[model samples]
Target chain A: MATKILIVDDSKLARMSVSKLLTSLRPDWTRFEAASADEAIILTGREHPDVILLDFNMPGTSGLELAAQLRQSHPHIPVAVISANIQVEIVERAQEAGATFLAKPLTSPALAAFLDEAQARLSVTRPSVR
Target chain B: MNEFLEQFLIESRELIAQATDDLLALEHAPKDAARLDSAFRAFHTLKGAAGIMDFDAMGLVTHATEDVLSTLRAGDRAVTPKLVNNCLACLDQITAWLVAMEESEALPEEADADAAGLIARLIPSPRPEQPAPVPAANPGEPTLPAHAAAILQEQIEVLALPQDEGTPGRTAAAMRVMQNIFTRFGLSAPAAPTEPATEDTARPQRMDMARIETLVNLAGELIVVKNAYGHAVSLAPSPALTKLQAQLDRLTADMLRGVLAARVLPLRHVFQRFPRLVREMAASLDKPVRLVTEGDATEADKRIVETLFEPLLHVLRNAVDHGIEPPGQRAAAGKPSPAIIRLSAARQSDEVVIEIADDGRGIDPAAIRATAAKRNLATPEALAAMPEPELLELIFAPGFSTAGAVTNISGRGVGMDAVRAAITQLGGRVTLHSTLGTGTTIRFHLPFTIMLTRVLTVEAGGQAFGIPFEAVVETQQFNRKDIAAFGAAEAIIWRGKTVPLISLAATLNLPDTPPAGIIHTVIVEHGGEWGAIRVDRFGDQLELMLKPLDGLLSGMQGIAGTALLGDGRVLIVLELNEVLK
Candidate 1:
C-alpha cells in the first residue's frame, strides 16, 4: 500500500512547502493538509493517514495536546511533532505525548533522512505504540 | 525577494493582523479563555515563522509576547490595560521589523536592541530566589565513570528533565542541573544574546521608507522645476531647450510615479493604534468603550496617514469622554454595558473618507444652541433659526465648549475646533452628523494623494487659482438671463434648480467688482452643499505638485497650497472644501 501522510500547520506556506518537498522526493505517497488540530483529527478519521506531521504551535489545539489525543485514539499511526522552537521543554513534552521530534526550516537532507527512517519503520509492519 | 521570503512576508503580516485582533479581543473579554489561547497561539506561530525565515529578532520578540500570553492563561497575570498596551507595543515593534525586512530582507541593526527592551517588559517578574552558581567544566578534572553516568541518566529519566543525547559526563550532568535550576527558578536564560545568523545577503534588497520618501519629495520638487523650465522654454523658444524640457518632464513624471508607488501605505498604519488608545481611554474615564476598526487595508499617501493620527485621537477621545455614558447609565438605558466606537475608512473617488462613529447618546441640539446663546457667540434668533447640524457645527467654533466643565480627558484647551483646524491644514475637511439618543459620526474627507493633484486653474480676482477637479461638478457661464436675487445671496436657475452663487473675488478679498453680464463660474460641492464660485476666466487643466503655503500664507482660510504654472506665474491652490463651505 502507498504511504499516506497528514501535514498540519496554521501557516499555509509551511504546509505547502513541506508537501511540495515530500512529493518531489516520493511521488507515490499521498499527502493531506489541515490548517488546525481539529481539522487534523477530522482528516485522520476520514483518511486514516499512516504518518502525521504536525506543527508544535497552532491557533486552537497545540501539537502536544493533539499528539496525546491521537496516541489514545489512533495508536497504530506514527506522529512527528515538527517545530522551529527546539526548546528543551517542548522536546520533552513531545516525547511524553508519544510523538517523535523533528526540527523545522526542514532542509532537504534532514527531511530525506527522517522520511527514510520512517519508511523503514513502516516497512516492518507498523511499530507498536510506546 | 525570492519566492520563499515573499511567502514569509505575506504570512507574517497576516499573522500580525490576526494577532492584533486577538490582543484586542483579550482586552475586551479578559475572562474569555479562548481569546487568550488564540493570542498565545498567534505569537507562537509568528515566532516559528520568523525562525524559519531566519528573522531571529522578530522570533525573539514574538517569543516574549507568547510568554506573556502564556502567563495570562495560567492565571499568573491579570489582563490589564497596561498589559494589553504592552502587547500592542510588541506588535508595533514587530511591524517595524517587518518594514525593515521588506526593505533589507533582514531585521534592521536595532532589531536585537528593540527585542531585548520589549522582552524585558514581557517576561514575567522573576521568582525571588538566589540561583546556585554553575561550576565551570575544567578540562583537568576527571570525567564521570560509565556506571556513574548511567546512574545520572536514570535519575534524569525519572525526573523527566531533558537529556542531551551525547554520552553523559560529569560536566554534562552539571550543565543539565544548572539548566534545570534556571527553569525551576522561573526564568528564561537570557538566550541568544549572541547574535543569530545575520541577514542573508542573497535576498533581494528592499528600500527603507525614509529613502523612498526622500526620493518622492525630490521627484516632486523636480516636477515643480520642470514647470518653471517649461515656462523658460516657451519664453526663450529654443529647439534644444524645448527638447530638454520634454525629456525632463517625462523623467520627472516617471520618477514621481515610481517613488509614489513606494509611498502608498495602508490605513492600518494609523488604525492599528486605536484599539489600544480606546481601551486605555475607557479605563481612565471609568467608561466601557469597545473600539471596532474596519477598512484597515484602505491605502493613502504615507504623509497623510501619519498626519491622521492627531485628529483621529481627538475624535476618539470625544467619543470616549463625552459621547459614551458611564456603564451604570448605559445599563439603566438598556444599552450594552460597553459602548461601541467604530472607526472605519474607505476610498471615495479621489478622496479617502474616515468615519468615527459611536453608539452613545448623540449631541444635544438644545444644549449646543443654549451654549451658543449663553456665550454670546451668536444671537438667540440666529441660534433658534439654525438647523440641528448647523447647531452642532457650533461645536467646531473656536472656544465653543458644550461640556459643563473642562476635563483632562478631552476638553482642556483644544476642542473639536482644533481637530477641524488640524485636518483642514492637511487639506482635509471634517463634519459631524448626529441623531439625538443615537450617536455621532465624525467624518473626514482627505485627498488620496498629497503630492500631485489634477486641478483646473481659474483666474479669480485677477490672480491665478487652482481648483481640484474632483470637487468640481461642472463649469458654466453666469448669465444675466438666469440670475436672481435671494436675500443677501446671489442665486441662479440651472436645470430648473436654484443654486447659490459666491463670487471668488469677494470671498477671497480680491479687488474685483462683480461683472454685470456673463462671468466664468465653477460649481463645487462641500458638506452636501453645492454652489457656483464665479471667477474671471478658466485656465488649462494641469497635473501639478501642491507645495503647502508656509509662514504668512499658511493660515489663509481658502487657499490649500501653491503651485507653479508653466507660464512662470504662481497659482494659489484653492481648498474647494473650505471655499464651498
Candidate 2:
C-alpha cells in the first residue's frame, strides 16, 4: 500500500498547504489531516501513520511538544515539525526533542524534494515508517 | 516608511497623542462626557484615518480598537489606567512599524499581532452574561482594531482598487455579493463558505513580503556585480580605448542611484509622530512644552530617517522628562515656566543637521561632576581639568548618572549613549552644549541617508585607509619643533594645555614609520577630547558606499566598516575615538 502520513495545523491556509504539498510530492502516498494535537494523536493510534508533520503555534499544545509526546507514545514513528516562528532557541529545542524540523513558509519544490528523499530512506530503514 | 505608510504612521501618531491627552484630562474630572466624547472621536478619527491612508492592514487593527472605545464611550464602561496603557502599547507597535518602514517597508515580526491582541481585548471577554454588552478593560489596546478593521478594509479595498478597477466583475462579483452584504454590517467576511471558493481566495497577488526582500537582495547583488565589472575594465589593457567602457560605467552608476532612490522616503514620516509625542509629553508632565518644528518638508535618504527615529525619540524623551524642569522650578530659575522644545532640521552643505533643544534645566556641569564622582567614573584630577563642555558631555558616558535615585523615566543609563551609537553607525556626529541651569542643545549632523559616506583617505603602513571625515577635527604638520613630549605620553599645546598625541601607525600597528621628514598629523576628536593620529601619507578624501563588516569582522577595534574604492581596492574606515578608548 502507499505510505501513510499525517498533517496537523490550526491555520486553514497552513493545513491546506501541507496537504497539497504531500499529495503533489508523492501522489502514491496516503495522507490524513488534523487541526490539533488531540486529533493527530487519535488519528495516529487509528491509522498508525508513518510520518507526522506538525505545526508549532496551535491554540493548545505546540507542534514540537505534541511531536515529543507522539515519539514517547509511539517510539517507532518519526515526527517532523513545520513552523514559521523560527527562532534559534526553537530550532535547538526541536532538535533536542527528536523531531526533524522544517521552516515555513515552505517552498513547494523544497517540500517535494524533502519528502522524496525522506520516504526513500524510511523505506530502507523502517518500512513501518510509511 | 514608504510615502504611503509614512503618511499612515504620522497620522496615527497624532491620533494617539490626542487620545492620550484627552484620556488624561478625563482622569482629572472622571465625569467629563465632552472629554470622553473627544477621546472617542480621536479613536474614530484614527480608525478612519488609517482607512484613508490605505494602510488597511493596520486600519483594521485600529478599527477594532475604535469599537471598544466606541462601546465604552456610550457609558458601557469606564476608562482606566489599564486601558490607557493598552492604547500606549498599540502606539508602540506602530512606532516599531515606523522603525521597520525606515529600514525596509516591512513590518516588524507579525506586524499584525498587536492588532489581533487589541481586537481580542475589545470584544468583551466571555463572562457571566450581563443584561447589556460591556467588558473589563485591559493593560493595552490591541495592536490593531479588528472590529472596524473589516469595514475599513472593505472600504479601503474599494477605495484602493482605483475608482475604475474596483469592480471584481463577472464570476467572482456574484461570488462575493453575499459577503459584500454581510461585511457591510461591520462583519468579518469569512474566508470562504465552501472549498471551491476557498481555493480562489487563497491566491493572493499583491507582491508578497518575501518578494520585496528578494527584490532588495537582487538590487544589492547587482551593485556587487557592477563593481566587479568596473574593476575588470580598469585592469584591462588600453583602458581608455573606447567610450563604451565609460558609458557602461555611467549607466551602472545611474542604475544604482535609481535603485537607491526607489527606497528614498521623506523625513516627514520620521518627524510626523514627534509633534504628537511632544504634545503628549507636555500634557503628561504638565510642563506646557510646545513643539516648534522645522524641515518637516526636507527629504532624506529613506534608511537614514528610519534609524534616526529611536535615537531622536530617546533624546526628545529626555528633554521632556529631565531637560524641562517643572513650572515652579523653571519660574524659580527665572526661565519661562512654559518651556519650548524646538526640533529643527537643515541641510548643512551635504549633511543633515537635526537639533532638539529645550529652554529649561540644562545639563548641570556640577551635577555631572558629582555624578561622575559618585560613579567613580572620572578621577578627581580629570574632573578638575576637564572643560565644561567635556563635563556636560559626561551624561553620555556609560553608567554615569546625576539623579539621586532611579526613576522609570530619566535615571536610566541608556539616555545619550544609544543616541551617539545610532548616529555614529549612520556615519554621523553628535555634539552637545549646555548652559548650567539655562538649557541644553544636542545637535546630530548626519549624512542625508545611508549607503554613501564621505571619508578621508590616509596612507599608513604602505596601505591606503579611510575614516569618516566628520571624525577629523583638524590635520596639521608636526615636527619636533611643533610638538613636545610629556611624561609617558606625548602632547601638543594647541590653545594652552597640551592634548595627548598618539602615532596612528603605532596605534594601528602599521609597518610604515614616519620618514625622517616632518610627519603629517591628523587631529581627531571623539567624546570630548582631541588626539593626534600620525600617518605616512594623507590623500584627497572620497565619498564611497560603505559595506558594513560582518559580526565576525565588526569586533576588530578602530574599524567601523569597510568600503571599496573605485579602483576595487578595499579599505577600512577607522573610528579614531574608539581606538583612543
Best by TM-score: 1
> Which candidate comes out best when scored by DockQ?
1
The digit string of per-residue lDDT tens for model 1 on B1-581 reads 86677777767666666677778887768999877877777787788777676777887888788878887888998998668867866766665556556666654564565565566556646872323433326764434433334434653563464544322322232333333333333444322111001111111223367688788778877787788787777778988888887898788878887788678778886787677667766876789788998999898888888788778888898898889988888888898877999999999987899999999999998888888888887999999899877788889887786455666567556778888877776667898899887889999988777768778888877788888876788899967767788888888877787888888988888898877889778987755678888888988777788888898898788888888776668888887656776
> Model 1, which residues run further than 4 Å from truth?
A1-130, B1-20, B29-38, B41-68, B71-262, B402-404, B425-427, B479-503, B506-509, B513-517, B529-532, B577-581
User: Interface RMSD (Å), each candidate?
Assistant: 2.0, 14.5
Candidate 1, DockQ to 2 decimals?
0.33
| Model 2 misplaced regions, further than 4 Å | A1-130, B1-258, B272-294, B331-338, B402-404, B462-464, B470-483, B491-501, B510-514, B517-532, B537-543, B564-570
Tens digit per residue, CA lDDT, model 2, B58-112: 6666666666666667778677755654554455445444444445555444446
Candidate 2 chain B lDDT trough over 10 residues, lowest sum: B195-204
> Which residue pairs come into collision in candidate 1?
B103-B206
